[model samples]
Target: MSSLLVTGGAGFIGSNFVRHVLATTDHNVTVLDAITYAGNAASLDGLPEDRFRLVVGSVCDADLVNDLVADHDVTVHFAAESHNDNSLNDPSPFIQTNLVGTYELLQAVRRHDKRYHHISTDEVYSDLELDDPAKFTENTPYNPSSPYSSTKAGSDLLVRAWVRSFGVQATISNCSNNYGPYQHVEKFIPRQITGLIDGVRPKLYGAGENVRDWIHVDDHNSAVLRIIDDGVIGETYLIGADGEMNNKSVIELILELMDQPTDAYDHVNDRPGHDMRYAIDATRLRTELGWTPTYRDFRSGLAATIDWYRANEDWWRPMKAATEAKYAKTGQ
Candidate 1:
């Protein structure tokens, strides 16, 4: 059995991945997280104690990271300051966690000669024109728009450099937007889901024409596991499910699923420099790794997500008020 160190495992995607690994594999997992505002300790509840452990700490702590890396057979990095609006409000933490923290992990993995897998977002490719037929591919050039994306882009570059310059055993996967259970209410889909649960009208940014390619968190994690087992070193794969929808359509679907009027939503001030659309081409991952998403039906996946939030209100209720207040300040 492999010993895995998962940074930010208390966060949404990371937590899901932690559970996925435990349920599907024999790997013993240790989570190293700072338990930041975006992270929730409750998200990781009820796992087998013998195989799962959580470490409250920062990835930027080199000594701690090195110690963990030395013992783990592999490191899966999922920690970062990932919110665009939050990064716009304050870029300092983004730089510190995304750039410096990645550098520290790279150094530690290099020192230990351990296998590493870096999880990144497709936002690094910026956006395609709404009418453009192109989608972001593995070869897409980095053109990040927000401080969050920029810093993540920088972190991806650091991993590439480390792989080439030091031959650190590492691979990278840039995935499209992921939505499923345990997502923090601050994110787009969860915000709408939780808002509807609270009898609050969903809010949209601008005309809501912004497009995003969505994937289930479980599918993304499955692709990550695929890469770790069979993918070539220093290679980069793109993970997507071809689930593209505009902001307006997503909100309308949420309203419809929640038994509300389709038009019963509010328009709000748009975010600054909001990209028009984001789409991902996962041809490489599919053709090479033989991976496919289980939740190919967007509506069903979204409905399942809604049911999760409704049934598990206790998990997301704590952050709902603060998240809404933050958005209310900017009328978004």
Candidate 2:
């Protein structure tokens, strides 16, 4: 069995991945997390202590990274400053974590000759027009629109360069929007879900026409495991489940499911540089790696997510007030 180091393992997607690995494989996992506002230690609670350990630290720490890299057989790099709104307010942290942090991870993996996989987002390809039928593929050109996306794009390029020049055994995957349990309230889905829980109107941005290709966090993690096992090095895969929905429709569905009025939500000013749409084409990953997403029904997945938030008030209550307060300043 492989020993794995998972950076950002306490955050939303990372924590889900860690659980997936433990449940499905015999790999012993080491989680390296900075416990940023988005990183919740409680997410890792009840995990098997003998096979799982959480290291509280930044990915930008080269010495720490090197030490960890030497012990693990593989490194799954997931640490990043990932919120678009936060990046717009201040780009410095995104630059440090997404760019510099990735560089340090690359160097450490290169030093140890360990296999590596880089987790990234579809935002790196920028956005598509609402009427456009095209979706992001492995060959999409880079055209990031926000500081957050730009830094992620930069990190992807860094991995590519390391694979070619330094011969670092690495692969990259750019996934579409993810929604599931343990997500921070700052994200779109969880933000709206929690707002409704607090008796606040769910807020929509612009005309609420922006589209996102939704994928369950479990599906994304499953694909990551497939790649780790069988995917060729130096290749890029796009992970998606073909679940696409517009903002307004999603809010309406949530309200309907929650037994609130369909029009119970509010329209707020959209964030600056908000992308119009993001869709992913995962044909390559499917045909090559034989990976298929289990959560295909968007409404079912979303309903389950809402139920999770409804039942787990204590897990998200501490961050609710501050997240809403930050959004209040911008009237979003």
Candidate 3:
């Protein structure tokens, strides 16, 4: 099996991907993350050293990226600044990691023999008409609204160019919101769960009407393995959970799982330019890769997630405390 190097393997999705790779397969895995406040090193706590190694480094470091590329056969890029709330205030980190970091890393890959896989978000398709209802496809128009998504969209374009111009064997996966265990507490799902668990009323932004399709991290990881092993080169795959829900409904579901009433939340002003809805047509992924979500409904997956948070307070309390410090420093 070829060696796999996963960037940002300490963060939420990246860390879950690493865990999936280590637990399910015998392939050698290497994780390179800068260990930002959001990137907690403990995510990869107990994997065998023979099967996994974690390197603390930024993706922007060209030498480091090249060294890892030289060592690994496939590179999955997931190291972008992901929080929408933080991206609004200072978009520089997002620009640096998403745009500049991608440029540097792709340049390195162009000099080597490897496949580069980029994990991107659904926010790239922002200009969807309020009334015009069409799920975003791989060929969806690039109309990103916020800084975080704009940079992610930019990085995806750069990957396209590298494949077109540099002959890099590359593929991209644009996915919907993901909720699962060990996710940083800043995201909506984990934030709501952790806050409610802590006996605090969770805050909802702008009446919580924004619609999103959410996929479990494990299902997302399963689709990723399919993309790496079987997806066509120079193609983009949309991996969705076949689930659609609004923000308010998601909160209510979490409340239900936690056995709390629906009135447990406090509404707050919506962030500027918040997209009202986002949905993706993942039929191509299903058709081309023969991939479908194992958990077609949110009930069991979310119930398990809530149970994990409930059972693992030791794991989440420190994370919640660390996020509070980061938020304080950034005034988020």
Candidate 4:
């Protein structure tokens, strides 16, 4: 079995990707996560012990990364400061983790000559508006607005640098907004669902007009697998399910799914410089790698995800109650 190192495997997309790797392939997946608030061990609870291992560590630790890379066949970097609001409050940690952390991992992988993959978001592409939504392709310019995007953009640059200077075997996938189960409550979809379940009206930012291209976590996991298994090294791929929706639209959709009364949301101040719109063109990935999503449609996916949270109140209730406590502590 090919050994794979997945950073942040305890987080939303990373965790889903890890389980996908386990179910689909015999690959021995090693997860290195900091177990931060966003990273939950429950995400990997179903993983078979023999096929999986967890390392409580940071990608910023070069020595630890080097040791892990030396033992693994493939390394996928997914750890990062992902929340847009958190990045805006102060981007320092984002830079430390998104840029410096990625740099350390690159150094480690270069030393071991191992295959590497970087997981990135579509926010790396600047605002894409107008009638024909400009789908970000492999050649799109980096125009990150938020500190979170800036940090991710910086990390993507480092990936390119390592490929050019060190000849590192690496590939990067820039994807759209991911939604599904096991996601942190801070995220849009789950935050809304769980909040509604807790007898609270969820807050919506701005006019909620910001548009996003949505991809279910499962589809994103499959796309990453295709990239790692068959993707050409030193290349970057843009993977997105063609489902694009605006901020207000998705909130309305979620509220509808939950059978909540209309007008159940409170309007919050729009985030500073909130991206107006984002969409991706997956032509290259689909044409070259023959990679596509099994659940590109969000209707059933969102329904199932809501159902999961509804059925597993034991999984989300504590987090829902602790929400105010943590924010009060963080002063957010």
Candidate 5:
């Protein structure tokens, strides 16, 4: 069986991807995570121990990354300082983790001549105007607005350069916003969902007009696997399920699904440098690689997500107080 090393495999999307890979394939997996506040080891519970292991370390640790890369047949990089608000608070960590950590991985994989895949966000393309009829494609130019997205954009460029300069076997996938089980409560969807569960009024940023193209975490991971199996080296793919909804609508849906009045939410100050809208065009991934998202209906997908947060309170409860307090300080 092929051995895959997953960086940030304990975090939200990374944990979900790790689970997806284990459930669907016979490959052996090693998770390298920093165990930061956003990374929860419990998310990885119940996996087959024989085929899975967790290594606690920073991806920026060159020695650790090199050793791990040398041993694994493939490296799927999902590690990064991904919270936009946290990046706004301090861009230093984002730079250190996203850019420098990616550099370390690229160098290691280059040395080992192993296959690699980079997980990125569609925010690297900045945002489209709310009224614009355009969606971000693989060809979209890098114009990231926030420190979080800027660092991811930088990381993506690093992979491309490594592929050209050193011929590293790496491909990148830029996915839209992901929501499902194991997501930290600090995120938008889970924040609202858990708040309603706690009888706290859900907070909406500004008038909540900012649009985000959502995708189920599983769908995103499935596409990632498809790319790792068949994608051309040095190529980039955009992943989306065409699940675009404004922040206002998303909050309303969460309230509705949670048996609360849709108008029971409160409006809050919007974060600085908030992108107006983000949409992804996944034509290349679908037509070229023959991959399509399973979660076609956003409403049903969101309802299921709400159900997850409700049923798995232990997974998200500890972080709820701290996360809400952080947002309250900034009134977001």
Candidate 6:
């Protein structure tokens, strides 16, 4: 069994991945998280004590990172300042965590000759026009539009350089949008879900025509595991399930599913530099690694997600007010 270190393991996707690994594999996991506003330690609760541990620290701490790297057999780097709105308001934290933090992880892995996998987003490729039929692939050129995406692009470049110049055993995966349990309320899906729960109207951005290629968190984690097992070093893979939907449609559906009127939501000003659409082509990962996503039906997966949030009110209630307040300030 491998000793795995998952940075940001308490956050949305990382926590889901940690649970996935524990449930499906024999590997023992060490979670290194900074416990930031987005990182919820409670998500990792009830994990098997002997097989899991949490280390509260920053990935930018070189000494701490080196120590952790030396102890683990593989590192899946997931820590980052992921919220686009927050990044637009203040880009400094994004620079520190996404760029400098990644460099530190790369250095530690290189020094120990350990395997590394960098978790990134499709936003690094920028947005496609609404009418464009093309999707992001492994060969897509880098053209990030926001500070958040730009820093992620920088991190991906760092991993590539480390693989080439230092011969570090590393792979990269740029995944499309993820939606599932443990997601912070500030995200699009959970924001609306919690808004409905709190008797507040769901807020949409502008016309809400922007589209996102959705993938279940579990499916994304499964792809990551497949890559670690069979993917070639230095190769980059794109993970997606081809579940695309526009924001307005998604909000209306949520209202319908929650037994509310379809037109119950309100539209607000859009964020600056909002991408028009993001789609992922996972052809390479599918044909090469033989990985298939289990959550194919977007509505079904979304229904399960809605149930999760409904049943876990205590888990999300603390963050609801602040998240909505922040959005209210921007009129979004």
* Per-residue lDDT over 1-332 for candidate 4, one digit per residue giving the tens place of the 0 to 100 score: 79999999999999999988888888999999999888888778877998899999999998898899899999999999999878877889898889989999999999989999999988988787746646889999998998999889999999999999999999999999998888888788998888888777777787888888888999999999999989999999999989888878788888888888767787877777888888989999999999888886788889989988888877666666676665445433
Q: Using lDDT as the measure, name the better of candidate 2 and candidate 6.
A: 6
What would you estimate as the lDDT of candidate 2?
A: 0.95
Residues 19-132, model 3: lDDT tens digits: 998888878989999999788887788888988999999999999999998889889998999888789989999999999888887987788868889999999988455466
Off by over 4 Å in 1: none
TM-score of each: 0.99, 0.99, 0.96, 0.96, 0.99, 0.99
Most accurate candidate by lDDT: 6
Residue-wise lDDT of candidate 1 within 192-306, one digit each (tens)? 9998888899899999999999999999999999999999999999999999999999999999999999999999888999999999999999999999999999999999999
Q: Is candidate 4 or candidate 6 better by lDDT?
A: 6
- Please give the range of 10 consecutive residues that has the lowest summed lDDT in model 4: 323-332
> What C-alpha lDDT do the candidate models reach, one value each?
0.95, 0.95, 0.88, 0.88, 0.94, 0.96
Where is model 3 more than 4 Å wrong at Cα?
Answer: 127-132, 322-332
Cα RMSDs, all models: 0.6, 0.7, 1.7, 1.8, 0.7, 0.6
User: Distance (Å) between predicted and true CA of 15, model 1?
Assistant: 0.2
Query: What local lDDT score does residue 181 receive in model 6, on the 0 to 100 scale?
Result: 99
Output the TM-score of candidate 3.
Answer: 0.96
Estimate the overall C-alpha local distance difference test score of candidate 5: 0.94
Worst 10 residues of 3 by lDDT: 323-332
Q: Candidate 5 residues 1-332, lDDT tens each? A: 89999999999999999999999999999999999999999999998999999999999999999999999999999999999989989999999999999999999999999999999999999999999999998888999999999999999999999999999999999999999999999999998888888889988889999999999999999999999999999999999999999999999888888888899988888889999999998999999999999999999999999889989999999999998888778767
Residues 226-313, model 6: lDDT tens digits: 9999999999999999999999999998998899999999988888999999999999999999999999999999999999999999
